[model samples]
Target: MEDIMRGRFSRSMITVAVAAAAVSAVLSVSITRTLGQAPAARPARVGGKPNFSGIWQANNEANWDLQAHAALPAAVTQPGIYPYDYARVPAAPVLALGAAGAVPGSLGVVQGDGQIPYKPEALLIKKQNAEHWIDRDPELKCYLPGIPRAMYMPYPFQITQGTDKIHIAYEFSNTARTIHLDKVAGPPDDTWMGHSVGRWDGDTLVVDVLICATHNLLKLFRFGWSPQRA
Candidate 1:
């Protein structure tokens, strides 16, 4: 009886050792395979700067108006009869579209006091442009939206960052601009997209822009002014 008990204990010890060895071998193989593979790639960077290479878009009513406003029945409206006697209606051009031509309300993107600090004279021109928006807005005419306007239009844009230059392409009118990080000659003539010179301010990118003559022309007809910087 003592010999049989000892034999049984020996067999149990051997079985436990074999199972442990099998598990150890499987883990060793897994670890070896993991270490042999290449490391995963990281996001692109230039000189320790963040990569801005991606498609981006703005989802807001900034394109409609930068100032806060209430929802309106239409983009254009005419006078209605005396106090509570009559309701306002859409103007001739957009009347056919009904609610489709209405302007949605926005909280406005302006930073301070929710008002654009327009010069008195410039403010008059702004009012006129608002009144004649349908006829004068450059977007309606499919013109290349310039500068900041291009940045916020309801469309997608792409940014490709490089060692010394960043390229931005806008879906609107296929417009594109290059932001130069290195010193370079300015454009011979003012361009629709303007000349953009850039520098990194810590992690932020500051850009200085000089607009084309066409932008000033548009200001008189459509947009207020060409942005000087972004």
Candidate 2:
């Protein structure tokens, strides 16, 4: 009778081991099948066009000067003494900030020859504005940076696409603009952020912008004049 009981116990232990192995094998197959499935797809285009919905920002010094420029000690500079005349020093307004006020260099973002095609008179005005930028730059006063200028300002902007409009929200001065993809009347008055009309050119979205004359304090640099395209 003792031998019979021992044999029954051994069979019970074997049954338990087989049950555990079967569960583990079932779990392994389930895990394998799950890992083999394809991942969920992300939307690459909207309404049969490329999607432009996302946060964007410029990573260059185009906001300083759209044309190619070498790094400078300061945005505001004056001639140094004697042999160092070519080596300009920072002007009083930015002198105290030292390296912190220095201008960073860039290869420029101009589409063509990397130079703004400013007329002779406009060129002179551009120089004057650069000299007095501390007082003249609208950005210094938390003013709305107009198109293309708003595009490259040292701030991030968000793009949201709609069925008939594309909206851009800029971090600078909390400015924003909308691109009309459908027909609409122009703004009754000129605006600081300007009126933007947009259309699809193949996969590219082309925008036509019109800014107000009052916001032209840096007109030479604004109005899509610098870097050709931002």
Candidate 3:
């Protein structure tokens, strides 16, 4: 009888140990799940509408291209010491470099002089473009001026919003406006702004420029193509 009592006590102790081990495992899983899944982060919203209220600058070293500037290579894998928030943007060569070939305005921008971030082929193209810009951009050649170029002109521009339509007015020569938003791509007419349509994604304004001037001219691009050394 005593031996039977000892066996029963030992069995009960083993059962308690198993239950405690099971509880510990379950607790660990629950804690891990709770910590790993984070809450979704939402963009800031205002006035039942998304607000895009940042001052955009047109003057930067990237005016020539979107990659890198002189002493700033396209293949650079690390950040530089200078603060280049707006400087990453390409700036026009003539404007960045003064008459004496001095980079007066590009002190914080170009680690070297006013030279831009360009591949060899692109550099050749830019040199040709600089020579002919007063006469022949794709817009003047009757094609869409492309998205980023139009957005980053030296002349100031503005964006106004209505219930369904958004307007972008340029201080450049064309005096053009992009009719888009409200899911509108505009009529099929080719334009410098190229049927730009915009929409709101959270607090950001998403704009799509259709019929970009990759290889063609717009009906509005009536400037004579100068036999000027293309």
Candidate 4:
């Protein structure tokens, strides 16, 4: 009887061990299959360069004023048509139109002392530009918005990149710019949109733009990490 009991106990222990091992093996195989089937990571490059293929935009009040500004009343206004309040006789067209045209307050993107370093004459010109912005602003006249302005115009822009060329198309005014990766001469004529030559500095896309006699340098890092895109 004792011998039979010992044999039965040993058999039970072996059965439990075998069952546990089988369960563990099944679990290990399941985990391996799940991990293997996971989506692959995004590629590092597209067409031998950093991929900048996406719709990009800037979300800030820089379009209104490059410098920090309080939410003050509009600079220009006409006599209010409403006769209810004499104190509010001079009201901006934006106010008359209601909240749709209200300007949101924002801090400046300019680094350092929060002031643009301009010569006296240049400062005077800037003031005049602001004072008569309705008429003097190039954007109001449908002029081509150049380099930095185009990049941050509170509108969407798309980048289509190839091995030897990159095309940037903007939503505002249907503005577009092409960047040649191959060696090429500057633009034949100085235009508002300018000419761009692009190269890769490590991971950043460095573009040197020449407009008229002025040279504007731009560096784009983290090509597709915008909140809207992400």
Looking at candidate 2, what is the lDDT of residue 2? Answer: 98
The local distance difference test score of each candidate is 0.78, 0.77, 0.50, 0.64
List TM-scores for all candidates, in order: 0.72, 0.73, 0.43, 0.61
**What value does the lDDT take at residue 46 in candidate 2?**
79
Which runs of model 1 end up more than 4 angstroms from their true locations?
A: 1-44, 81-87, 97-100, 214-223, 226-230
Q: How far off is residue 113 in model 2, in Å?
A: 2.6
Selected candidate, larger TM-score, 2 vs 4: 2
Measured on C-alpha atoms, candidate 4 has an lDDT of 0.64
Give lDDT for model 2.
0.77
Residue 125, candidate 1: alpha-carbon lDDT: 74
Better of 1 and 4 by TM-score: 1
Residue-wise C-alpha lDDT for candidate 2, range 1-230, written one tens digit per residue: 99999999999999999999999999999999999999765467878898888889899888888888888888888887755744988999978778867888888889888877777766777887787777677786687767667888889999988869998988889898899999988779867766788889989889887645454534533222332222
Q: Is candidate 1 or candidate 2 better by TM-score?
A: 2
Clashes of 1: 0
Worst 10 residues of 2 by lDDT: 221-230
- How many clashes in each structure? 0, 0, 11, 0
Q: In model 3, which range of ten residues has the least summed lDDT? A: 220-229
* Displacement of the residue 140 alpha carbon in candidate 2, Å: 1.1
Give per-residue lDDT, candidate 1, residue 42.
Answer: 47
Query: Which candidate leads in TM-score?
Result: 2
Clashing residue pairs, backbone N/CA/C < 3 A, model 1: none
Which predicted model would earn the best lDDT? Answer: 1
Better of 2 and 4 by lDDT: 2
